[model samples]
Target: MDWITHEEDVWFEFRGNSPHQLVPGRFYRGTVDGYADFGVFVDLAPNVTGLLHRSELDKRLESLTWEPGDDVFVQVKNVRDNGNIDLGWSIRQGENEFRGARIHDPDGEADNQPVESDKSEQTATIKTKPVSGKRRHVGEKSEPKSAAAETQSVETEVVEAEPETEETTADDESRAPTASDVVGNLEEETEEAEAESEQETEEAEAESEQETEEAEAEEAELPERVSLGIIGDHVGDHVTVEGTISSVRQTGGPTVFELRDESGVVDCAAFVEAGVRAYPEVNVDDNVRIVGEVERRRGELQIETEDLTVLEGEESEAVEQRLADALSDEARPDAIAPLADHEPVAAVGASLLDAAEAIRRAVLESRPIVVRHTATADGYVAGAAIERAVLPLIREEHPRDDAEYHYFTRRPLDEAVYGMDAATNDVTRMLEDRDRHDEKLPLVLFLGAGSTTESLDGLGLLGVYGAERVVLDAAPADEEVAGETDVLVNPAREGADARDLSVGALAATLSVAVNADVRDDVSHLPAVTYWENCPQQYLDLAADHGFDADRVRELREAVALEAYYQSYQDKRELIADLLFDADEGLAGHVSEQFRIKVEDEVETAEANLEARDVHGVTAVVLDSDAFSHRFDFPPTALLVDELHRRNRDGDRFVTVAFGTDELYLRATGDLDFRTLVESAAAKAPAAGLGAAGIREGRIEFLTGAREEALDAVLAAVAEQF
Candidate 1:
């Protein structure tokens, strides 16, 4: 055997093998070969030995005796060169104890001693030779065989001494030298020794045979293969194991159930009729076992049955009953009472309650509020009153001086009350009042003629205050007074009023806006309503302008279209003319570059066809004023160069549009052109031929009069071509 050593650790390898046969950090089962005061010697593996220190033995086990040939399981703690090895043997705390009998002695007792034979002495001497060098301590008990042998020798001496004593004492000296006396003494001693040896041999042989039988039995019991199964297989079919259920669901007629077990978990299902009846009691972690048929559902094995048994007993049953009662109560028509009456003052008071709640949520979530109000007496009074209620709530929620609130009122007090005149005492007084009152300064609500109009105005305030609107329906009252109130909160028929107010709906709306800001209960509100109610145009614009040039172009077109439509619908003519002029100019320039004459009468058709030739060039503009004309200017050339560079470097497709006096270009690539444009423009001037202007103009290049005049020359050549 070849051995390898790493410091105190050693491992042995067979000859011609690359890997060591025995390694450290592993436990092995072996037999005790010998023991000394220092430690017990163990045969760790075939041809390998290790030491189990006396100190390492469990204190309780140490008191019991041990001998050679005793089997033990030990961990290889360390190994050393020069054939030294260290081993440990002790059951770890919390581990299961051994099940076999606890034997304290290796040799049979005196009463059960076997008869001795002459050959046994030689064998005994051979086995004991290796252990003779180390002596047992004075207090230690003698070996079991030694004590038994001493008793037998003493008995033999007593029997032989009686015969010798019977002979004459005077002739004893003469008889000691005689052949008969010496031969007789030697023969008796030899017979006694042979008897003891024979007894020891028989006992050793019996022990060896028993060990061999045990080994054979253990080998027979070792399993050849192992398999795993769910606990339901062993337990009753309708059994339930309960814990928190994750990802619970139902499909079609069957309600699926997944129960987790110690090893893992199993999937089960119940029919619709079964599921509904079970639903009253079948909650997550109810500790119920349902008996069902084991079958496959959607390619996965699941248990299906109608029988249910609650394992948690009384507690789970009571919970199920209470849940059923609550649900039934909620389903009744008269579950909630109707409102009493509608009063303007009371409605305002109720609105203040809602406003207070909104403020509390906003403060907790660290979000701003966008309020819209009318400048009419009712608007002022309501707006002022809401501010009064909300500001104190916010201050109470957040006392930090660093806390911020922004106001985007319908119009500044100066603009609304004093107009352009700065000398008015009333305006000055109001300004002083607003400055002095922290609540008045942060009033973000706007005043308008109607609630719908007010909501619209409030939309603009959203961008300024980073807030969302929480609308409260106004109370139904006399038309004169009702029209002027902030919120129409009617107390007459509280049930219908609550339905109209929809606390859940409002919470959802505010949740969508402030979810990312709030940390607590407010964050738990569902976001479905926010997405559903978001303006389609803004959402569409955001989607199209997804931080890219294509998106930017789409956004620019949307913005320009909206502005043009809102400002002047008749500008369609201007748009068309601009597009046509830009197309003509671009055709001339490209024709001049390619040395091909573009046809005059057919220029529009030719430009469209040519644009289609370039990959990714989806839309082409013929109107110069269509926001694509600015690209033709020299200052905007850099943007075209950058775009052209990106197109060459990437697999993106490009689009060309011609504005009336300018050319517009856009490309789609992996890199974000919007961020690039923003970055480059940051170093340049705000406007007037800066990077941003160039970028905008490149996508909307403008053509000079000279270039427009050249269109005729190109047209003449295009006619010939």
Candidate 2:
């Protein structure tokens, strides 16, 4: 008889067997059907399949050379009620390797008797067997099969065996009783057996319940709650810990809860099932008690939770208070003695403390930080300073090697304002990361930018999604800018001269406040921002840190050149070498290129400068559109600064670079660009003389009102002088 295949009745018709008839812990012949990254699927019957999990393989999954439709052997580890089959690896790849035949009857008792395969009946033709009468199980050795069993298509073995003894024969005869004896004693035997079974079942259930109660009692008698700081000593021991949940992350196998107590933070892992959420009641910022055994994973200590319970009422309040108190004491600012007397510095220092605390909280919670800054030497220096301090802290907190990249990012913007373009880009990246990788939303830190009302639209977009923002700038920000951010650190907002401070100087101060150990490395950065007339206080600070003017200039120029090439990338390693390790010769080589590029641009701008007198003030104006390399290095800001330095002789002098739609301002006298632009716009409203770009010391005006705009701007400059 030949076998036939059918789609609707595939399993029963293909082999005269169904998957429901599969026996657990039994070996079966199969064919490789398909492969997956995790395991392989094997076809045992037409419609019955089983998975050979990667974990059960003696060798790597990739090492298996089997192809689809190839014959293979496997053991059925289990047959679940849902009809799922789990398979284990088999060392006996050939059918002859197995001993003991099973004579399976369709409707009768299946016995362990070697027999030949009846092709018409679809049964196994197992022939090998061991010498002993006892049946061999999986993983046991079997004796060699006789030549007849191997050669004959349908053959049976006639084995020489011992005959039954007199005692066995007599016992068998006594066990087989007559019909009269069976009917007479059947009721009594049935009653006794039923009573014994019930008694045994009752005893077993009572013992199980008692063991469960005792285990629960032991869990309830846990010792006093201990701090996570002392958890290292309690490894391999069961203990109880109470804390607030800082974060919760789900993985392929376990759910990790980041617990923060007064002492420190640790991760507790719980596994209910693969890809299933454990302790579904737990959430971030909730107070809970975790009872588990401490274990080490990937060289970091973690808790294997046996029981977890959320706290309420007084318990929750107590844990929250403890964490708050500990954070306050540990993260409070200790000293700003470096600039205490400077009221502007002191005011910004207070805000620095707040910003640092917020950043620390984000770190503790495993939230990412996105730093946005202007694409300038000042902005890059400031942004790099914070990056240096925060990276080391992130690495220390998160044990993974890629934590720095995952938790922190620094992006340089072409303009100072955080407009819709920049915000949209950031939001897209963050949302994608959250969806694809299960990452939490990030905190946006605006350094050296986003301090004007112009950025409110961009900030509002982020706020709509509950993302937080922090702004740290030296430019005087609009009053409304403070309301748009979580932490605003600007001296001008607190009544001080923003002109005297550089964003680099302010941000470096804040970076040290974030991590004090980097103070010596960042102290020199403030002095480097001043091209001339350095403040005595900042110069003294730099001198104390052993950074003279030449070394400061070298670092400043090196960073400027690098900022121009790949204006988008953070260039982390290159900038770190240039700023932190000045002796590496990288700064010298790059600074030389910076000098050559700036000198060429400056010489051209000076030659084409159109000088004029406006209301007794000497004004130097350059049509940068005609004379400058519009697409080259040393931007308009740097060009104007160098022009003012070389040409200005009197107190009332202003150097201006006119672009297509905007103007750059650099002056020798105490001229407030913010005040000048505001007053100018009021005088000539049609000229569009606005302070929109005041953060970068520039103003936008209507091209049609060129003469009126220049006159209004120069009048304000003259008045201030």
Candidate 3:
């Protein structure tokens, strides 16, 4: 939870004329230039590219979410003699992970941006091992056992071996080649030198043979093969591993082969040369024997490979069978019990099982899961429920300390419809992870979005890439989107009345199906999602969980308010603490802020409310853009929903909250947004009236025809009333 801060004194900025300014082991703020098969090329200066190899990264290279031109912090690993730079993964990524950054000085080898104070802190930095490569590059200053140090040693020996000039050198220089004796004397010198060379060569060969025999004997006495599940126990120890290669990634310094056994997967680094593939014949799915030293790099376990061999016939089959049996046992879930009983949820019980299985399977398989939901109280609760359920599984499955952060993700959607823009972003990121890191495609879960026809295009994009999709909506789902979705959870599809069912309720049940251990944590979640008309069962469940009516209201109100401010962020920890922990101090404080902000907005909207009567319906309209905080807390749509809830002047009335180009309708009865749009369009075709979203009765029209569109839409709503 601690983030590293990039103070001006600690990091360096480079403007590239030469790579000389780029000190190895020093942190340099850089921009993402591009990605390579081996590593990410970061440009500290215009031409200075430092390699952040896959082996150096905390997660798989493909798992990186960085884009071209994005500013990043990289530690200068080694600047080669040829000017090629090798970079190591900065454990502190983001100004540093509290903010989510990667940065550091190379080792204590350079002081390009040295802090004047704190000598202990500056010197005690992450020590980078000399990266093995064809060139064996090193930073400017030499450290013991480094390539540069060896080069320096060899130079010292050569200098020391040089003959010293005597005082007689002046006479010897004048004498030069004096006679035939001088030419004849070459025979004696050549013969003696040849004899010495032959004896030295023979002695050197004998020493090499002895060393080779000792190495072979040591190799024969191998350590026991360590299972990946318990590999953490053998960290910093030499061990052997037998498993099938799940994926292969080449780094600037090493080729990482992801080995998977029945227990788990771990990265095994094999280096033949820099930017070169190691074990070329050993491909993915090949059962292999690996001998390596288990080590921790960037918080993840890795094997520094000593030797690797492709297993043959009998050996391969035995490992393959073991893996298959283990996968079968691990992947399938035991019989599931719903968190709470509800008829609507019961209607889609079978699909819910399948959905839960898919989610659990993704975790077992190490595939990342991305939960996308609308930015609302119910939507946030739905996402949080899954997040809470899946995080423990991720931790249980992977030994990495940061596995939960890497494996599970929650992103908020502004609109309920999963549109192209959102889909494109997901596609780009998933493709990069797969192509770059050899990572499996992610499972995309839609909490409150992607259940309608409008989401078909977005869901279609994911389907094209073989990414699994799960959509859970309490409302009736479109047949088109349902058909495309992998696991659909919609009780309305089975002819059940789900109008009053909030997504939070469905998600709470589904989260239990994902990980039943968290049932107690999510028990009261269903009650928090409902703003009104909460089921008696859910409210009672909340009461049983120690969240009384007031507590539930405060939590819901706080989530709704917080969910709006940073409408895009998942606010993972904050939401988790609010929902699962529900610490009185934090919840009460946030809820108080929520109430104050909502009340202020309500007062402002009330002063600007304009009322008009069309037929028997009273149309309460507000120009939201003109009167409300458009960009701050309590968004226009939420404000409109809140406004419509309190101000119902008549038995049959519609609250028309219209912005410049868009409007939302909140009516007392079943109002068809499509029919309303059609009616409005017919009345004012030039206005280009259209339905944006049905859940909110959201309509969009030309800003130029605001008055005309508003008039026609109000008339249409009056007719529906």
Give all candidate RMSDs, comma-separated: 32.3, 16.6, 15.9
- Return whichever of 1 and 2 wins on lDDT: 2
lDDT of 3 by residue, 257-325 (tens): 878888888888886654568888877668899999997654578888989989999999999898878
Tell me, by TM-score, which candidate is best: 3
lDDT of 1: 0.36
The C-alpha stretches of model 3 lying farther than 4 A from their native spots are 1-226, 230-240, 244-256, 272-288, 293-302, 309-325, 649-651
Better of 2 and 3 by lDDT: 3
Give the better candidate number (1 or 3) by lDDT.
3
Candidates' lDDT values, in order? Answer: 0.36, 0.78, 0.81
Q: Indicate the worst ten consecutive residues by lDDT in candidate 2.
A: 5-14
- Which is superior by TM-score, 2 or 3? 3
Q: Estimate, for each residue in 1-721, the C-alpha lDDT of model 1 and write its tens digit.
A: 2211221222121121111334455444466654433566676554466777767877533353444566666666776765567787656321123221121112324321222335535653212222212334348576666876776545443322344464576676554476886899889777766776677699899999999999788545433211113542542333333322222344323355545322233555554331132354555444554554454322344555445555566755654454345434322222111121223223344443443444444443323444443222223323333333344434433322322243212231211211123113223433454333212212233322223321233233332433333334332222332343333333332333431232222322222222222212221111111212323332343344232233223222322222222231212233223222323443233324322211221233323333232222232223333322342221123233333433332343443334344344444433233343343333332321111122122321124442332232222222222
